[model samples]
Target: MNSPLPTAWLEIDLSAIQNNYRELCRISGAKVAAVVKANAYGHGLVEVAQAVLEAGGEWLAVARFEEAEQLRKNWIMAPVLVLGYTPPEQVVEAAKENIRLTLFDTQTAIRYSAQTSQRGMTVKVHIKVNTGMNRLGIAPQDAVEFTRWVSGLPGIEVEGVFTHFARADEPAADTTDRQIRIFDEVLASLRSVGIQPKLFHASNSAAVFNYPQAAYDMVRCGIALYGLHPSPETLLPATFRPALTLKTRLTSIRELDAGEGVGYNYRYYTSKKERIGTIAIGYADGFRRVMGNKVLVNGVEVPVVGSVCMDQCMISLDGIQGVQVGDEVVLIGKSGGLQRTVEDVAKEWGTVNYEVVCGMADRLTRRFIHSNDKKG
Candidate 1:
């Protein structure tokens, strides 16, 4: 829609996105609230949000007030609930924009109500219960009181009750069951206080796949919508495709002498005189400097002979040839016959798949490509 994009772009198959959403829906049999936060995990939120909705997603979720604003400005008419904290000052704008806020305490809702009513508008709010994640959300015991207090406040709607799971993605998790038990307890507590929120939800991508019962009225799925299983145990009958691919061009190729040191600290050295190519990507591009001295190419993985630099990293390609200047090098995403999934890299990095996708979002210049347009 704007100017011509660069040749090296993160090609997103919108059709794949749609298929994955539908597949996720099928597997979970729950309404999908595709999480498009973190710029849609670096897949370009506006474009990915549009694609998801077009493919039959009914609700959207973001983590920040400004992200919701950007989506609203882009004409995303779905119900968008911000899953993170929002300050009192921004409550009125959240109301005016029809964005929702997550309430971890009664004061946030009360403050928001005061601010929103002064502006002659109301904002829908979800009361978050901290079961065991120990991150955000109010304590389980306090959730009901907070919900009741917020529900009765002017210019605020207690539209939902939710919680975060600590290990829903893990196989045979005892912890998530406890979290859900707590969630149900809070939901019942809300009813006791006569605060019947319109929506009851607590499932993320992991819960959607592994724990279906957690899908109350809606399920918020981030990584799953982008063609990734949040955990290996996440059961899905439908095919999902990874939406983002990070590719860079080879800048140069050179030879290294046998036994010569390579990279910082000499982490890798040549056993023999070998050919090497420096690719135009490095830790600066979110390619983890720790991926040090390791490269995957030509369906055969190789080692990185040195420390990763800021703007660039060198890959050893001894037997691998036919790679000249500008040969496509896939640091992440799919490239040629050789492919490395985000899950593959995340495990190597001692991180989650969510982190890997978010990693790509943080590292590269994202390009959006809408591959399908069948509307809902």
Candidate 2:
């Protein structure tokens, strides 16, 4: 572990993660392949991967080869997949590390034929079908031909076939259904060619909660495992809780008078005398300036009375008492006597719920918290 920094920490609830893993399995008919990419959505890759493994995750996925390498460096022994672009040149090292690669093109597979030859003894791969997302993966029409040529190649294991969903969160249901239909067709085409990749997956957080029909041999649980719904109304089982909490110290307290302005451009002007608490975290620490619309202090919703400077923001402590220096200020997570999950931040920011808590970048020191003080 690195030396602990004095900055505000994001405490992660390990127990909640375990609960989410169990709940994900209960809802998903297939086994779970937990997506731990983007450092497990900024909760720390190795830590969250370990938690998911402990909670019974069989496969782990990252968006790139380096993330898999990092996890392997920490001795995380599991089937780690590289879901993003993997240059043919990197295939040799990826195979050596036993990392799985996703293939979307026959040419890319051919270029890595040498690595593929050696990889039979070392690595495996999944074939990604574009289906309807059209972002990555082999086009549905060509996926069969692509899979056939690669399946016969040396040093290759046809591990899985998968697709991404584009509109799973939109209340209108037609688009997600269309995406699923195309994906099922791709699977049928693969079976027609006598190719049955062992695992098949089609769920992001949105689809896993809303569409159970798409879960094949596995489901990729990302944001949901961190206890965040894709949207407020996104259907979910009752067991999940958010694993991350963002908190900082109140650096100092200041008395303000009526009509006094605060922060850059003076976005807020006090209407009456009040106590203002300046927190150490600001836009520099991953709390977006857009979130200034609403934040909280001691369970009372408070206005961030400023333009939100780089390293600090102030919250008005009006209609409250017992203001002091060094008091705890929670931007996300439970505090004092109330719970403020990232879903709250997403609603306040009017953006995807994943981006809200994932907004807590790695720059912030993550101090792991537990269900009680004794374990901490």
Candidate 3:
């Protein structure tokens, strides 16, 4: 017996991810670290990480220790960096697995040192300087001092020093340049005291194109790795192809006469005789209620005509011809000459592309497509 078909599914092209990694590498002219945090921004963490590694990417950065641990569990031995906080208790396990951590707080550094020292192991750490982000990181004025203090610890190795851009995605904003100047000053301070770490990086995806000068030793490619522009103002070249496509099949269709109501609370009403379609996708599948406005059927744009439910939604097939039950409906991806991108969906949802993709529910089955697969 075969397993039941998924109502909605995500098709992830691993080849597209690899192509994007190579493009980022060519553009940045630096070692590109693939940011696979947030489950590779909801593209399947292990699968995306493996794809990047196959594409000559050596480093994998995640937002938390658990993500790094998951990578390790999958036997992915790439140099993994936890870009966010790692609990004091997990420092030892992190060290044992050879995971690099972002160090900013003195108390956390002290705990890391103690844990590593007690275990007779040394853990590599990247010092994060708060170059105007005002989020995580040591104050710029105190970065040198903190680096010196942390360097003196018995089991902690200051392997890298980095900062994050606050507004690199905005081309007209001067915040990126200001942050670059501040970071350069911090690097100069560290070097003056002979505390130059092996790596110095400050470029995120947007900065990779907007501020190439800030691409120090390595560049962190997150959204771009998935072929997404960092922001509306910072567009990537046309060559970067999006790796994921959302699709579902129409399950049922019904003819509704004029004055008929549809969906919960009767939010939609038929103005004329219309063919309504019910697809096997809804908010539970990451198609939010607000997105009930449009989808693609037979390469034609159709209007979603009702309040989206938890497991289903309704679309008006009023003039579309030859669209039958079980015909493929595209929520995101190209259909004929028409294309719906994450950015397009983001615009409809009043959010960013990152949230639109990352918010996809885990229940939605992911089917990876690797066109270049030669392992067989």
Q: Write the per-residue lDDT of candidate 1 for residues 235-346, one digit (tens) a residue.
A: 4445777777777777888898998887678877889998988887777666778854355565566666577887777888889957787777776665456777777787
Candidate 2 on 329-367: residue-level lDDT in tens? 788866567777677777777777677766776778876
Query: For candidate 2, what is the lDDT?
Result: 0.80
Candidate 3 structure quality by residue, lDDT tens digits, 169-256: 9979998999999999999988999998989999999999999999999999899999998999999899898999999999999999
Model 2 error, position 71 (Å): 0.6
Which residue pairs in candidate 2 have backbone atoms (N, alpha carbon, C) closer than 3 angstroms, thus clashing?
120-155
lDDT of 1: 0.79
Q: Model 2: residues >4 Å from true position, as ranges? A: 1-5, 116-122, 372-376
lDDT of 2 at 216: 90
TM-scores, all candidates, are: 0.90, 0.92, 0.97
Can you tell me which runs of candidate 1 are displaced by over 4 Å? 1-9, 235-238, 264-266, 291-293, 296-299, 361-363, 370-376
Which pairs in model 1 have colliding backbones? 293-304, 294-304
lDDT of 3 at 69: 97
- Please report, in order, the local distance difference test score of every candidate based on alpha carbons: 0.79, 0.80, 0.92
Error of 1 at 154 (Å): 1.1
> Candidate 1: worst 10 consecutive residues by lDDT?
1-10
Instruction: State the local distance difference test value for candidate 3.
Output: 0.92
Give per-candidate clash totals.
Answer: 2, 1, 0
